[model samples]
Target chain A: MELTRRDAVAALAAVGATGGVAVGVRRMQDREGGEDAATDGASAGDPSDRDTNEGTVRATMVAVAEVVYPGEVDGIDEFVDRFLDGRLDGSAHASGLREAVGELADASQAWHDAPVEELPAAEREELLRGIGADTADEDPDGTTAERVRYYVVNDLLLALYASPTGGELVGIENPQGHPGGAESYQRGPP
Target chain B: MSGAESVGDGRSGGDGTTGDDVDRTPVPNADVCVVGAGPAGALVADRLAADREVVVLDAGPRFDPDDRLARRERAIRPAYDRPDVWDVGGERDAHENAGEWFYPLNHARVKGIGGSTLHWQGMVMRLHEDDFNSGTVRGVGPDWPIDYADLRPYYAEAERELGVAGGSGVDNPHAPPREEPHPMPAFEPSYSDSLFAEACEELGIDIHSVPNARNSEPYDDRSPCVGYGTCQPVCPSGAKYDATVHVDRAEAAGATVIDRAPVQYLDHDADRVTAAVYATPDGGEHRQEADAFVVAAGGVETPRLLLLSESEAYPDGLANSSGAVGRFFMDHLFAGAGGTLDEPTRQNHVGFYTSACDEFYDDADEERAPFKLEFFNYAGPSPVEMALSGDDWGDPLLERLRDGYGNHVAMGGLVEQLPRADSRITLDDDRVDDRGNPVPRIEWTVDDRALSTIERANEVQVAILEELGAEVEWVAGPDATGPAYHHMGTTRMSDDPAEGVVDPDCRTHDLENCWIASSSVFPTSGAMNPTLTIAALALRVGDGVDAWL
Candidate 1:
């Protein structure tokens, strides 16, 4: 019953194919049942197949986010996808969020073809630190890896832990709160 | 201003009724009608619907937090500017023209079940007792007909309803005595909060944890906050307070919520509102008759609704016999000072705001100037806003954010705005909303009293920053500064009709059934967040309506 970001993206891709992107996006959302399927497919293959550049970036950003908030839940990938694909248009602050992810991915590939998990924690940390330092120096004008690092990590944290899946992780037994608490302290609806 | 009427789907209306409506459409109705699903309306309906029929109507559509997050890549985005096609008043000119400085003043409030509380920062504080009796104590602004004692019980009820989390220890001198402890523990403070608290202690000022409506524990069925940093967009965890929770409770209690029901005007008889007329999303007109009417449509929309409903009974507007439908508007004045701290005290804290000050809240000596310096809470703007406001990108931007994020502590002052007759909300001939209601024309100018208070507060902010070992900078503006969204005192409460619009009970003096449920009924703009007071007054108004029924 848990919804994942991958399911949302796949549904979004299907909607895009049907030429009802807006309607499809709204529909996919109306029914909250598609997350399991989306996340299932998401974990099976490399996200790079969808949009190579953006996918590579997203994966790299996810790796960087894992460094900031280790052992984050699964929804972080979907959050990055939504941001890069332009879901939060009215609110997004940075323009090259997706591109920064791609650069990090490219750097990771160039440095070592091994999956991020294969690398030792110290090596991974060093790689991210090096990338951040280099990006900070090179793109004095563009969104440095340092800046993007925080964005990616923060978004991932919010998606993995702040979303419903994350709520389950923290063992929030009441979901909204106890019924009496709902009536007494309830400010809004669930 | 130009008036051009465009019906839905680019059609023009020839006879006031659009051709789309000419095809007779069925009207929609609910049992207990809630005009707006904002904090006040939502809370009232949620509580009242336990026994009565209730229908909550909002002008906007319901939004899923997950979907919203997926759309806006960043967890927290600015109130203004977005990737979505939805016009959340995203256009910058609206905020700029309104003189909003801190955050976007006219950002889109979600039209769905939750209302604006979805994105609020959840800093809930009770207004000082002096705020209720400002006219008597300060001898400025119109006197409140009802005192704090009259509202204390309701405030307690509201606190319970909102599930406020704070330490209500007797040591706190400024707050009224609470009958019960907070529903949950206070949110853990950020490094900035601790730094501010230390600085306040050094200055011999008492600082404590700010009371928030955000759930610190699973009080209701909702989950606790997860420190998502998306409090401005939507709390995906449902930890932060929003009206949607109440709408759900209302629904469970047999209350219905109708989405996209935009009320246009009210049909009134001499002193009683007979019915409310609304235009649906499909360009259809619907009228709902009610025994009693509650106008919880916010300060801007409420007055605009009254002015739009001008009739023969009251030529100026509904309940405007006193000519005070949209007068005496007030918003808290905010200013910030930033400087380098002496120590590396920054840590990744869980929540945004932690410390507060009340030492200068009640200092009313004329020789010492009349304003209070309270701490302003923010984890700084989002990465994008910080980048935009500071030097464009690179190490400088990163260094600024990293260095300033926790080290910087801001103190904002909310001065009591003297109710001048000129600071009013009138109808704008040019700008019209989608429903053709005239956009409220705000003709406000800060009085000498407010300016003097601001000047004094600015000096105090600078002194405090210096004392805290911070290198300081102060930002100020003309009479109008900060966001107008914290709207107050348009339909003020008073003992006499000549001085204000609504009576002590928030009922319009001339209209028997018509009631105003917003910060508009405030006689003086106090130095605290208006959300708590707005909810308290709404609870009081709901009780009055229930009594009348």
Candidate 2:
């Protein structure tokens, strides 16, 4: 069976995410990271992200996608989850995805009393904020930090913008998936 | 068409078995062999195909846009910016910047049948009259042998052919004289455009409608632009003018077009290119001889091909008698600024690059290089984008994405980069393209003159942003986009053989039968997009070759 869009490069864009938010709009990590102090997830040798199974990584990513895009990404989480656990074309830099998810889960468990996927929406948001704030200036030139950003934020955004719904948010219809043709100008966001 | 077979992407060889034995055997001679199936080569081949035999070749696939789309989907999972349809995915390294210059040339210019035109945003503009006299008047770079007057007619013709939508006698400062009106009126201005006009007006800056190649009202069998928001990387609809249309025209006019055929060498005897040799995907060679040859293989590939076509007659390279084949390189000095505006402006999200101002070139700067600013109504550093800065994710992320997603507006400019002998393209010793040919290594820089210009642009951007009550989010340095997409001036034209590679007619001084129809022959990089000029020159070069033939 053919791999779905969400399972394809949207998952592989974890490689791109590890670098920065990509597809040319904004790849550079930003400043003004809002972080909350670590309370629970902090542990010796990073005990927060202990579950390194492929399933945990995929589940964490689905939850993370919801956090990144909110209500806009409700229906497409499964395919993205499949893509994260599946193979990717020219996926040169996604090796750290599992570790990245584990890090997020570790942070979630440390801050909350559960893994990242099991954390409450509000807590997940708070944990992601803390991680982003912590990562804003950390590893100014390192790949590990970039990988973290990817696991938490960039990959989800990549998947969102690459999808038909995402393209609609940006005003592109009848794109590569369908036969090419013109439509009435989309004046504003739906 | 001309006894030369037309080969599509699939019909061509695949990997080691890329070429069939029949194709590998000697092919019949074409009257004119045009390298590159992009706009320039396609225009040349189309102009010559009616009377003279022509054959076109491109290093990328030549599937219908729809077919290519299907193939891309079936091959890779769906994603934005998937460039397998256009990007050569091989040896062409981005760019190597040396010296104190901090420019990173990671700009995307394609190598497909339509070249970078497939991904163009359709902001077409002609070079100013003074652009031809930079060498004589500004003493910044070499002057063109022919002036704006010589190119004016061809510009009109090209505008008509490309369906340029622009105002007639809008009386903009710093624009070249036009003999005829634009084929179509300017596209409707966005709400952001009106706001920008008001804001810039308060600061005494004038913004005008930019000429675009996208159809305003269905011209040239192409549909009008439906404002498919994402224009870069690829235009989903055929509304935006790309070279694929002209390539189709060339084929319809009885010219054989070959895809996935990379020209390896040009067989020459002293001053004449006898045949053009190309490599197949399966590691085989296919030679196509022609009475005439036009090298329109884009700025990078055109020069690289010349350097690669080295023989005993010209060890340095073919058409390198003056050693000017790959020197004097230039791209527009690009820089921009963007931030969140005080209020929501969804027009910024829905429109095209429909506005521009050349106030930077309105009054010439004797101290620094001249620049022309273009405004992007759709400029963005969206709230969702800024959320990556670690500000928020859940409710906060939605809030930010909703707040400033459409409220951002920005302006960027292309400053005229004066041609310099030191800023050149030399063959890289180590890196080889997918075809195993040595790629061109660019040694580019911006002097203090350009730095000052950039500093001024930053000031202007800040002023405009502040005028609109927008907070400054990000400011790119002098060369914001690195080298940008407008690659020009490598195989520059000059009447003097010692100082230039091609003549005023775009004929290589070293070889009379060879003509350069690409922007590679630009003597100076104008402060605007170069596609219209490239097409005009290709049409001119087509005439020159036709007359010579």
Number of backbone collisions per candidate, in order?
A: 45, 9
Please state the interface RMSD for every predicted structure, separated by commas. 14.4, 11.5
The sequence of per-residue lDDT tens digits that candidate 2 reaches over residues B219-313 is 88887775434455445556678887888888788888877688889999998999889876667788889888999988777888899999999
Please identify model 1 stretches exceeding 4 Å from their true place: A1-190, B1-31, B71-87, B90-105, B108-112, B188-190, B347-351, B365-406, B475-481
CAPRI band for model 2: incorrect
- Candidate 2, residue B146: the lDDT equals 95
lDDT of 1 at B1: 5
Provide TM-scores for the models. Answer: 0.71, 0.74
Instruction: Return model 2's CA RMSD, one decimal.
Output: 10.9
